[model samples]
Target: MSTALVLTHSVTAAEPSADGAPFGLAWGPITKVPRPFKAEHEANLTALFYPHGWDPANGPATAEVILVICRDEGLQQVVWVGLPMSGEALARTRRAIHAEGVRRYGEPGVGGTADSEVWPGGRALLASREAADGNRELVMTAVGPGYAACSETHHAETGHPAGTHMADLIGTGSP
Candidate 1:
């Protein structure tokens, strides 16, 4: 039941733009997303994605793009799950993802596993991690007052710290 918690610590990056959208999807409202997705909702989080699957240009073909929406706050995160692969594919995907992050958000911040890297941005936090089993994943979470508001609401309701859950919610580990 491991879940990937959203990074709540203070960041120097500017606040997320209200209109900013990652993965061609905007950052507010679930209705804005297209249909034909396998969907589920629990508490303040709603997870959905096209069952046919959408793959990032630089990502692996097996990857599933999961859209995470925070109730009331709209689309808060975009998750890309790359199914387990051989060493070479894993390494290549990791490098490509990291390079994309660097190009978009510049150098990453401290505190990343050898298999992971995180880039803080004015609009969101972009991160990528590779599981021990060679599952590569990339995550982007919206930042700013809207996110803080949602976090506070989530904490008040769950009695636990607010953060995104990957394993239990989306059925994966160390996303």
Candidate 2:
């Protein structure tokens, strides 16, 4: 994260200013002026590398998505970037993810899904599995939508209890 924050300005000037007061799309960092971000954007990067049984030390054998929520208007955020593997590529990622899910969460709870009413009016799908291997358990969320420019994936925990987290993205019950 850089100190520079990109913003849309209403000022219709060709350049900043002749007096060189200081003004443009870049505002550096907000050190004093209280311009609070009303909403929240979470990445859950703790499980970013591998929530699956795979060993992170073995290397980066996984994929991920960086959801860039651009606009936050309370109850919902309209614009965003959702990236994940898809089609033949998704199949490869899911195989590895599924193997870990079944190994850690045991069989049956591992599955996937595709939806028409995906976020932002498009189709999307995800295949993830969870196991009772540890406090973090092990879950893999690999998804991409027609609306998004790319595919994305996640390996994380149930956060609360083992069975509390539902794989709603998969349209299936938890393992």
Candidate 3:
């Protein structure tokens, strides 16, 4: 099969805060060469998401991107990021992303899943499923304000803008 690289991002309403920091999670750009997938790729990606300990049923929200890196050796590697999203508006954003995936790639081979954790303030951590193909899928969820903090941390740690990193990860040049 011909390999494909996919990346998606969704914007949610920023949460109101007296602190006035831009509220929303942003994953740093990651880079990967395009590749096709087999069943193992999907399984591996799913396994990665579960370890973060999030459950989507609890009302946390997420945004994610899936990357499939195919090799001549017949193995595909999938990578993803889980960002927190919560509440009704964030949930709607997640659903919209799912719909977009279905429209573009047809039915995903796997359904979305999530794991949760607690962060500072009232915010919670989440990892929700995003998109999937025969080979890979992505899941993410995070609180609005908390998301922004995480994004900042990611940028500081990586030394490059998240959007730029994402572009490199998916080989899409730029977002």
Candidate 4:
């Protein structure tokens, strides 16, 4: 696999939720700070992707909402991408994502396949893998609006591993 450019930023505009959650709504633009992925980072990505199987919530034990935007070939492919806090959160976000899938692709199940007609401005596509392996990487690629890609890496040993690394490359921004 090619080494991807990892970027991160602290979202300061939004306040914590009413319940005092660690997550806040990210507005404006995410700062692009390029950094190499370390072993710890990989472990974290595993947890996020497969939280149910991970023994203890190693991180904050809080649900963080992330919006992943991707673009390719000068076209905007996806938007408002919300990652669930845990495996249970997956069920909740799944429905909403399915709805969006239908709206964009005219179909609900877009798993493990390349979808060229999913988004309005999206072109050239690839879907996430079906196998739930921690080491397995889930990614989608498109080329049109601009070169963009979203990658999710699971843990290799444990069945339940929070995604340690989730990265997106959209337009000129990196996160």
The number of the candidate with the highest TM-score is 1
lDDT digits (tens) for residues 117-156 of candidate 4? 2334333222222223432122332222222222222233
Poorest 10 consecutive residues by lDDT, candidate 1: 6-15
Cα-based TM-score, every candidate? 0.65, 0.24, 0.27, 0.27
lDDT per residue as tens, model 3, 1-175: 1222222233222221233211222322224222322222221121112112222111222232232222211112222342433466446764565454344334444211223222334232122332343222333222233334443444565554333333443333442
Tell me how candidate 4 scores on lDDT. Answer: 0.25
Q: Which tens-of-lDDT digit does each residue in 111-161 have in candidate 1?
A: 233434456643334445555665544444544336666667667777653
Better of 1 and 2 by lDDT: 1
Candidates' C-alpha lDDT: 0.49, 0.23, 0.30, 0.25
Better of 3 and 4 by lDDT: 3
> What are the runs in model 4 whose C-alpha is more than 4 Å off?
1-84, 108-110, 113-175
Q: Is candidate 1 or candidate 2 better by TM-score?
A: 1
The stretch of ten residues in a row with the least summed lDDT in candidate 3 is: 43-52
Local distance difference test, candidate 1 = 0.49
